[model samples]
Target chain A: MQQTNRLRPFFENITFDRDDNELVLNFGPQHPSAHGQLRLMLHLQQEQVVKAHPDIGYLHRGIEKMAENMIYNEFMPTTDRTDYIAASSNNYGFALAVERLIDVKVPRRAKVIRMMLLEINRLISHLFWLATTALDIGAMTVFLYAFREREYLLDLIEDYCGARLTHSAIRIGGVPLDIPDSFLIDLKRFLDNMPQNLKDYEDLIDQNRIWKMRMENVGIIPTQMALSWGCTGPMLRASGVQWDIRKEEPYELYDEVEFDVPYSDKCDNYARYKIYMAEMRESTKILYQTIDMYKECVEKNETALMAHAPQYISAPKLDLMTQNYSLMQHFVLVTQGMRPPVGEVYAATESPKGELGYYINSQGDAYPYRLKMRAPSFWHTGVLTDLLPGSYIPDVVSIIGTTNIVFGEVDR
Target chain B: MRRYSPKDNVQKKPYYTDRYYVAPQVPKLDVESDEEFASDLAAIESKFTVSESYIQLDQLVVYIDIADNLGVLELLRDERAYTQLSELSAIDWLAKDGKFEIFYQLLSMSRRKRIRIKAYIDEAQPVKSVQSLWRSADWSEREMYDMFGIKLINHPFPKRILMPDDWEGFPLRKSYPLQGDEAASWYEVDKIFGKEHRETIGAELRDCAKVDRYDTERFSRLGFEVPKGADISGGEKRKKVQYQEDGGVFLIDRFDEEKTVIIRDKDR
Candidate 1:
């Protein structure tokens, strides 16, 4: 039977064509396993999915539109809302793009502090992914254990920035404040005990039969398909591609840090999970290195906070209160904002999820003429429509969980 | 400590001169330079126009004519091995040429290099879609269509992805208002539920509204002025005939009782 789009005289429009033995299921928009408002329309032939169409934008807030209207500094807080899971990464990425546009050089100590915050954010984000993905695959113990460590990291972030989730701790030319003295003590403690907590998480699900059965061979995507679909981060790395922006592009002080990019040829859900766990361990190593560098800075009595460019970067609050010239500079920076050069630049950081980039086109204005956020999750979500067709209905949950698609970045 | 001046050469800055600030090499590709890549692309087709190319912050950017976007992208992907279409986005240039500049950020994994392909199209003209080449272009092109209203010709499914299907104008355009426009008023909550069904839900809604009204009065008495544009009347005008039977769920309305409790507690 041929499907027809014939108009009816007195009836409302019918959307789908009637077919026998075919079921259409709306998987999300409000399903817990869907992970943050992703709605997939799955066409199932009995139990196997025939076709899956992702219906995104349930969380769209027009963040790019908002960026154009606000001043440079004013938009920093809004970047926090883009990928709220790793807000510090989003902040640093946006700041890097603006700093590139204006050709500003950050202080050495500021760069170290920024790198420390970014690695800490990576730990927080990967832990959340582990907890949520493990729970989605029926390992409830891993979820409980992951969140416990995540809480300790969030507390350290809160002590530094006053906000736990949305810590807009980075400024354009540097970081907003110096790391509190207690932050070093607390972070050192967390780093000391992190390996044991990771071991606990691994002990729960690493060797379990059920966990292996569900995640080992399911949702297998090859290296070529992953690349063609623009899969970055662990998804691309899981397919045996050693493309990490931190190593390749080396933004900030990442070049100074020594860490390995983990990859696996399995190219399945299990490989992706292992890559996330491996990444967390590497982040811990990076954290220890940063802490040592920070101690060196403290011993040398170095200024490890904001940059010294008074014309472009804002002055510190203490300086603004004391000096007349610093006060005027702060007032101008807050009100008028700095104007970047008339050109375009794309700055990318290896975010917890993937290569989170900000492409800014400046017309020498306080606000960007155009700001485009190339969120890694946006491309990862695009691959789902191609990935879910051959898999079974039950496997759909595992595939979605493995992709780690957060709607905040996908919809922004 | 020395004060830095913008007039000073950037190379003289201590931050820029630091040993840790080594500029990473843009990995060697099959082609020696961007010129070789452009020449190779031009060799594939005479219609391909490769304009002035520059290195911005260590990444190569190439400008291409809008008409040969697909041809150039195919050459870059198939022959040159820039497999990943990392990002596809549009920039609205309303103030300048009244044109929209579309950017395709491509990455070559084999070479570990990034190149940006840019094509400028007028607001009305449609750019050929590269969805056939890169599957990731599907959503990114849809986003361009949704945000800037720049149509991508031959796109598989050209429906609005971010905005509602019935959204009037593109929000990312410079001309579009930041706070939204008249189309926002088109969403009527009452219309979502039909009039017959709305009356059934209307009674419960009114009870909530009555509580809100009581709180508004209490707040005003406490010297807090109602914010402008606040619905202080609490949807009273939109309310239908109230259902008379009370569920008697609340022994006393919380808003009303709170006022008396505050007065008595102050006396004590």
Candidate 2:
């Protein structure tokens, strides 16, 4: 067949202009792959997206506003709603910020227990990411397999705290309840089983051509771009920046634990996925070490789980029941909550999602004066406007999944 | 119901204080106390004017001119190597000082130090957008506008990020009632059905707990269900809820409890 440019001038005059050919597709606020009320307004020039604007705040419950009215202790449970996937991380982040504000030192046993909960939460959240990302990328078997393991992890958290999703396991100053006797046994069992499950997941999709094709080179956030765009956690790590808050800022027993931060410089979705996989392994290593540390504390007969700052922390239940003075103090502490010093502190913790920071300003009042949740998902969501352009429409799902953004955090 | 009070001026009254309450303050150290912070401040002050700088909680806090946000942030990023803009937002100081204190938290992974650039702007004053310096500031500045109604100077697409485009008032303002204002009560009614239907919809409850379950108008009780305006003084009869239509779904089989199979064993 022979093709000629004889009618090129005639065709050029009548052909559709770039503006005329451009189409706008509204991806979500309803779609499952949108990952919880993330409405993406994608402007497409044919199959390639010209621009993407993430429309957020479908889940904004005015948590910051609510935090203002509630007492310091009351706000801990509300923090769980920020990143519901790993609720304990949100709990600990707020608790750590308040602890810093009040200058309270946690008992060693509680510190060890908090570290274990954080790592378990990291594992649970990462497994959830694995399940959902695979499900979104059209691999169903891994979703089922990943969730099967996720249930066991959630059960471990359930043993620690009563609730699974909104586990407010952490408290201001110290933990409320001591770690259960069965918890360590269950954690030891789960830590042993997690490695093989992680291996099984890699075997399922690591080398699969379609999975690689979807994730290998998609959503490449360069190292400089990531920093400028406020990327953290795996997003920052995958971009080759070796910055982890756990290592840089040692809160609780993170300084005592031995674990490596997993990072790769591929700067793509696959690198982020591999980082998440390696991080779960690292979390297992941390859990094993922390459990041993916890046992040593138990052997030393350090039974005090809550910090003994009577002015700040509530007295132990046994003391409250027996002693009238302790009961009176408990009543006062509960009625008019502990007043932190009038100062603003920006405390960042490496949440399962990213650097989940709480910028709490106190007015020497029971309630927080102004509270801002620096959610990792919010920046990751904002970066989409820059990342989504010049990519195919289908890649949007893979990118969103890899970022691991939950709207609970984004629209908080 | 509790006695009605004026909601508008609630937050205007200063926070309660007493003779017994001595406001404790966090110790703020001089910037020169930390050698690393001293150098960082020296570099920042060389090019731009710094109104005040101090170290609080190991973070260097600098109060800069609101206009010089972009220049200072650019210098920090390009020159000082403080790559990440970790947090950016405004605090409501309107009750105390009638000004909003805007803070920008910049982090340097290489140096392992944090510096905060803060500026105070009068209420409703427009602040310069740092979206050019840090891309993350795009949504953040929009959020500041959406929440506090703080206008931006030169932001590209300065629309509301959280609230709807037609939202009436700034929700995060200290004066704004936490329970909601009059405009909030009528927001959804006006949004979904237009302002003309405001009378038809009445007013939305500010508190969900106040809604009566047995009102025979809106709510439908689980066991004691009845029609919209049913007179139930004698008490409505208890009934089992029907899951499907009377004729059943066309292709779907009706469930018979006698023959229903339950997977009791785990992982069946």
Best by lDDT: 2
Assess every candidate by TM-score.
0.82, 0.90
Residue pairs in clash, model 2: none
Taking the tens digit of each residue's C-alpha lDDT, what string does model 1 give over B142-240?
999999898878998999998888788888876666656545433333447644675443422211223444454333423335554356554323332
Writing each residue's lDDT as its tens digit, candidate 2 over A1-412 gives 2244776435534565755898899999899998899999999898999989999999999999988888888888898898999999999999988888888889998998889889989989999999999999999999999999999988888887878899999988778888877988888888888888899999999999999998999999999789889999999999998889999988888888888988989999999999999999999999999989988998999988888888888889999999998999888778777888998899999998899999999988887889999999999998899899988988999999999999999999
lDDT, residue A65, model 1: 79
Please give the TM-score that candidate 2 achieves against the real structure. Answer: 0.90
Task: Identify the runs in model 1 with alpha carbons over 4 angstroms from their true place.
Answer: A1-19, B1-47, B188-268
Q: For model 2, what TM-score does chain A reach?
A: 0.96
Best of the candidates, DockQ: 2
Q: In angstroms, how far off is A291's CA in candidate 1?
A: 1.0
